[model samples]
Target: MARVTKPLSQTEIKAAKPQDKEYTLRDGDGLYLRIKKNGTKLWLFDYYRPITKKRTNMGFGAFPEVSLADARRRREEARSLLARGIDPQEHLKEQHASALAEAANTFSAVAERWMALKKTKVTADHAFDIWRSLERDVLPLIGALPITAVKAQTVIAALQPVQSRGNLETLKRLIQRINEIMTYAVNSGLIDANPIAGVRQVFQQPKKKHMPSISPEQLPELMSVLTTASINLQTRRLIEWSLHTMARPGEAASARWAEIDYDAKLWRIPGDRMKAGREHIVPLTPQSLAILEFMQPISGHREFIFPGVKDPKVPMNSQTANMALKRMGFGGTLVAHGLRSLASTTLNEEGFDPDLIEAALAHIDKNEVRRAYNRATYLDRRRKMMEWWSEKITISS
Candidate 1:
């Protein structure tokens, strides 16, 4: 055993240096120093295992941040843990786990973390847009509340504004998103049950069916009016494109050049972005092809076929197309989406097979027999049907 000196005094401890090049003192009993290769000093602590007689090293922080008194107190606490057969490192791990769960307890905090995880799986733009919408609409009402405290009523309140506007689809989507977030919280051990689960009881409004299409007798006049409608060239292209393809506004809005195969006369939408999460191959008619050619000059160099006016990064806004339709005196008469109804109704009247019509619309069939047999094999027939619809509705520049 080495000759031991008395415990370090406060005055001496404050002035001590690790590299005087004259004295040697091993760090033990909470006294420590780090002698750098350049002779700079950093304080640390050292101890011996009580049972194994093996020495253990402990960091006591840098010199200025950690004073001698603070270091001694921390060392004493650590020694007490060793005496209780508990490693301070193991205790710290448990503390970290508990702190993480506590931090994730609130809706806002958990949502932020959930968005972070979602960023890895989705585009950054999509993640930011979705989280920001939740922050403004959903989070303001129940964000700071504990995930466990989020009741069905809270979710219903968040969706009331959208629901009141007859946006039941959007309401359903927002509610589903909240439920998904709550499910994630449960998975992370921050909540027990998903508050949004089976939350349909909260919605008293009866679900409304899609609007009826314009009567057949009004089709010729509607087409004539649409032809002379004073809208932008891009807006005209969108209207014509929608009518020609009978596709959803979202599908046409986000259509990309790479998705279009001019040779095969097909527009292939990827499964991930498609609402049904199934790849859709739209057989293009001459009219749809003509619109694509006309728009190519503007969008050929870019990624999105129908680029937004303000930002080339995104597709054209769905609102722009709807507003253009409304401006043509078609509000509540012929929506941008009403084209699907027009086509489906007209084709069914024309004696086309129901399976073929459903396949053209990419609407999932409910009947197992129809779904099992529907393979979209009538591309040529669809191409002809779309051409006839386009000829019926003419949009002048």
Candidate 2:
């Protein structure tokens, strides 16, 4: 007959002290309090591997923090696993890995990874808009779901509200963005395939009306009206700047002083702000520079050349110019973006090199080599074209 081991008491455990070498006191079962030479107390459980029968030691935690009762409770859990022919250490590892996989495979987690890759290719403002769209439209719906578990029907349900609201453009973009993210998941090994490949097909397509613009002949009258328009000076100037630069409403509104090459008379709009997703250099004409000079006292210290009246920290709203045009009795007749069409028409009619005009407008050509040539070779001709275009739209003219 063998003698049974006695259980340790709390009083005895507290009195135990460190010595020359590390030592352990048996508490009961496989639980032990390991006292190191430096007086660090650790809780450990000694056990045999279920399959190999090799003895192993598993750590619970360090002493006083873990206490004797906690160690005993942990030892019981390990023994319970061992009794079921499972190794406690292996089970712990499996739990840890499952937790990691769960965290890594969520829609939001993988989407964040995808966005990190996008930041290198897009501008900070564009990146912020992309994430905000997801937050408002995508994340709250399915962000916590595992990537693989996200099916087309699930995504359609999330987007159905956007379609119902008649924001077809926004709905369309949201689908495209989600598709890109799912593709990113596929490339990142989070999912085998993009489930939202045909998601855009579920929504009605937005009508493709050309941006509303007046004919070339109407520009002189528009300029005449602009000279004495009731709108504020900043909005009028921004409209003029957009026309002279042939910048999209969004691009002109967010123009930064840092992007202006005053010496070269060029405004280098970075790729992220541009719809074409490339850096576009607009040839700044005398009229454009004059507008900039007039704006100096109002916004020279701010980041934006056209800062918002209410919030100097933010660039002017992209719609500011359109609203100002409406105030000038051009509502629905022309939009801020339509200024590009007006410029294109006048320049093309005047027999400027079409390719140079295209370059000035930052139009991305289908042929990659030719596109590169257009970007590289057209600055001088484009500058001259912009000068003529500027004089054509001159308020003084």
Candidate 3:
């Protein structure tokens, strides 16, 4: 065997370059450098297992990328491993596998996976809206960046366009989803932290809230105009059900005949159909029951409670209720969401428990304790409150 030599210096190694062939110089300490025929040089190390009488070769990296000093430092690490009876080559393979797994876990890939898993459980319209926002606002900027490289500044820049247009609600929502995606990336070990964590502290500017609803004192006249309006009968019933049950328009429009127990006077909305992802039981007041009875003649075994006029397979068009209000000269004065606001505010003013009012509207409180206790505590009070609200909204000609 050739005698081991001292580790070569960078200047000495370059001087010893071959004219037409590759050469590898080994320092007896298991580190070496290979000068390629094309003049491309790389650092490498070699070691032997005394127990198995086997040789292992390792590539430190290409020259300039891994300096001569770094190569020797790695060699010392491998020697330390050998001293502990560990196989350096096997250790490197394990490390490479972990790094590869982390590299594959990026923001875009993780967000897509989250969407795929969540889409099946939400409304088709809701799912479409979320994916559309991601494609338009979130994806173009940071989708290609690795999760670890996604700084909070990147998040603010991604949402600035949405904020510029007075879409603060959308901006807030987008930040939430981005935070969720980053959190998923962190949990998967692709990133060290959620860049969006505590981002709200930076966006100190408050969102412009939607205009509050018309007072209940104004609701009587509003309902009267809606009753005789030129809208479809289905739209009329939707408005009534929305007000009487104090449920969301989306929930009312998509209510299935099967979910209603007319005899029990309850409408059981499935967890998947709700924004809160919890099953909600809406009590059908006498007025709400009357409308359901009126709809019974038109409702079919294979249709929505408030079926789309042109397409019975789907719920009524999202614009149907809002358009009804506009045609009655209540355009910007009212919105479908405003109806929920109206109910919550009006009910709270009437001395009802805030928890019961929130439950009647199917609003999700973010407080863990509130959510945990209210899920079971408020059903009876909510049923009574909804019944009273229905009585108050009736046109007492």
Clashing residue pairs in candidate 3 are none
**Steric overlap count per candidate:** 1, 0, 0
Better of 2 and 3 by TM-score: 2
RMSD of each: 6.8, 6.2, 6.9
Local accuracy of candidate 2 as per-residue lDDT tens digits, 1-397:
9767788888878888999989998877888889999888899899999999999899999988998888898899999999999999999999999778877789898889889998888766678789999999999999999888789999999999999999998898889889998999898777788878998887899998888899988887898888878888999889989988998788899999999999998899988787767999998998999999999999999999999999989999888898888888889889998899999998999999888888888888999999887877888988888999999887434
TM-score: model 3 vs. ground truth: 0.67
lDDT of 3: 0.80
Could you tell me which residue pairs clash in candidate 1? 34-42
Candidate 3, residue 3: Cα displacement in angstroms equals 7.4
Error of 3 at 149 (Å): 2.9
Q: If ranked by lDDT, best first, what sequence of candidates would result?
A: 2, 3, 1
Q: Between the candidate structures 1 and 2, which one is better when assessed by lDDT?
A: 2
- Output the number of the TM-score-best candidate: 2
lDDT of 1 by residue, 226-322 (tens): 6788988888788778777878877777789999988899998776556566677788877788889899899899998889999988888866788
Candidate 2 yields a Cα-based lDDT of 0.89
Error of 1 at 323 (Å): 0.6
Q: Candidate 1 regions off by >4 Å?
A: 1-96, 109-133, 144-146, 149-170, 196-200, 366-373, 394-397
